[model samples]
Target: MTITTREDEERLRLLESVILNTTDGVLIAENDHNQDSKIVFVNEAFIKMSGYNKEEIIGLSPIGFFAPDASSDELAKLKDAIDKCEPCNIVVKTSKKNGTKYWVNVSVAPVSDGSGGFKHWVYIQRDVNNRRRHLQALEEQNKKLKEIAWIQSHVVRAPLARIMGLVDLLSEHHDSEELSNNQIIEAIASSANELDNIIRKIVQNTENVQNQSSL
Candidate 1:
């Protein structure tokens, strides 16, 4: 019995240590109407992410770290979900101690006692600023590529097609006896060469754009 009790205590201590040292920020808050939501627990990751110490955060409300322009409706919805013991995901901007705002993806769920009574709300947050920026850049690049395709299809190709057609007609009648036939043949050759050069340049430019986009 003594050995079993000691083993159980060691296991509990290890579990607590794991919870407190995880990389993802973890916060446990109690729902209290008379006072602000009390932060009962915060892990080391939460302290590092928020630049707050355990003593600074323990009795404070988590919402105080939210941006000043945060939506009340969203906060209300999150509170309602927590009250009903539902898990929910919300994206919001959070401010650090220096007032620098960053985007976070937060998931909240109810923590309950063994008897099914509400104990506290547990929130897990991850920083998503880099991912958001990459997504936005991809969107902008797609828009630019669409614009370039429109220009190539409409503006560049139409004129090239007309020049090629006129050159073909001149070449077909090159056996004419007229003295100006030689001049016409020369002009046709020049137009055909110029059109080929233009097409090649356009294709090369488009391929370069595509390669850059992939990178």
Candidate 2:
């Protein structure tokens, strides 16, 4: 009996240590099905991540941590999952106590009572601000590259087509009295100049995008 008690005590201590020392933020809240659930427990990681004291967090609603512009649809889906006693995982924009907004990956699951009803819910969240920022930067670069491709394919082709058509017309009508070589040459020069200007503008736009990204 004494050995069994000691082993149980050791296991409890190990479990507590693991929960308190884990890197991911952990929280437990009552699963109030009809109302907003209040936070009851938070781990050390959650306290540090949200920059909130235990007293300030204990009775707060988990929804209070979301950013003002956080998607309503996502919140609705999360609530639906909780109501159904299902696990949910979502990436959301969240805020700290200091009003600084960042991104997080949040997971929630129901903790059921033995009788059948869910007594509580557990939350696991991790800061994903760096990854989100990196992806945004890549998206911006891709947008700029797409614009460059459009200019190359459509804008550049317009002036080149005009120049080619003028050259062909001049060549075919050289003996005819309808058109003069100088006029055709002048038209070609103007189209070439237009193409040159378009190229310069594209280069400038590209350089601007690159410089902004570097910053």
Candidate 3:
């Protein structure tokens, strides 16, 4: 039999409360040969995050358990880490109980059994869907900016230069051996139209960068 003081009980309650209420999902998995890294314990936050009950979560393999949509390469990498008994941090798309998918960052570390042997793996899962969306938005914006730059530097330059040269030629001579007056004006109009189209494309791309990030 064991004895516990009032202070010990209070401390235990505090620990349990903190673990249950924390926003980050926390779970413990069995690490022995018999268990094959199946989950043994999960906190309330994990249950809420996974959209599954505590009973359903327990006894399930932590790897690919919540993230069925996770790629094989990601699962293999995590399996390799588990095989080596090393800590691993991976981000993958996971499905909730409702079948909707979200991004999560799962970090797992080996927990010692106090006998100099590995006993369990403690996983800390953080929902990172917002972060992933923000990153993708930033990437989209960067791509648009690069395209705009290219249009300004290369595509826009050609038409503007053509327009400027045509105007200069019109100013110098209404009719020339190289071209007629109407031909020069037609060339100028064509260059202007091309420049207008390029500008519209750049504007469309910029608008896309702004609108597509709503996802």
Candidate 4:
């Protein structure tokens, strides 16, 4: 039988106090290796995160915490790690008691008993829904920027080439046709220069935006 001493009890209480007040959600469960695993304890942070009381979740399998319809690869990977008694990290979506769904990063490790077997699992969880959304927004912006760049390269080419050819024709036939008035030739060249400057500004602005997102 194991003996309980005042010194051991004091140390245990100190550890419990730290877990109880931690910012990240902490959960300890019996390592039944699957949906059968039973939750043994949860910290205050976990209670707040899930909107569930200790009495409501304890002694129940964690299947209730995960959404039944969620069949994502991350969920499957977490299950596989548990079956192998290994440590794993994954971001998964779960529903609170009020049915409000959110994303969290779960880091779990198997705790071994002295007899070469895993007796329990320790899980640390933190919310990451906002971070995921920000990344998705950045991806969408990058996609649109790429489409704009492609249009500038292909669609604008024919018109710009035509402007260059017209300028060249003016230079060669300056004394040929009555249409080659000095004032008229100068106006056309000035207009072509303005269009070139506008296109350059658009390309430069696109590069600036792309660079900011990467940083």
Tens-place lDDT digits, model 1, residues 1-215: 69999999999999888777788899989978764467888998988997878999898876665536356866776767765779888787778777778778888887777797876778898888788877877897787678777867876666567666656667677455552556665766766776677678767777876776677
Number of the predicted model whose TM-score against the real structure is largest: 2
List of clashing residue pairs for candidate 2? none
Quote the positional error of residue 102 for candidate 4 in Å.
Answer: 1.3
Q: What are the runs in model 3 whose C-alpha is more than 4 Å off?
A: 1-6, 64-67, 168-175, 193-201, 204-208, 211-215
For each candidate in the order shown, give its overall lDDT on alpha carbons: 0.76, 0.86, 0.86, 0.78
Superposed Cα deviation of residue 165, candidate 2 (Å): 0.7
Q: How does candidate 1 score on lDDT?
A: 0.76
Off by over 4 Å in 2: 31-36, 63-69, 173-178, 207-215
Candidate 1 vs candidate 3: the lDDT winner is 3
Per-residue C-alpha lDDT of model 4 across residues 51-167, encoded as one tens digit per residue: 999999888765446646345787788788987889998888888889888888889888989899888888898888889878887887778788777867775665566667667
> Model 2 over residues 25-144: C-alpha lDDT tens digits?
998888555567888999999989989899988977776555364688878878788768899998888878888887889998888798987878889999999999989998999999
Query: Residue pairs in steric clash, candidate 3?
Result: none
Off by over 4 Å in 1: 67-77, 168-215
What are the models' TM-scores? 0.73, 0.81, 0.81, 0.73
lDDT of 1 at 133: 77
Worst 10 residues of 1 by lDDT: 174-183
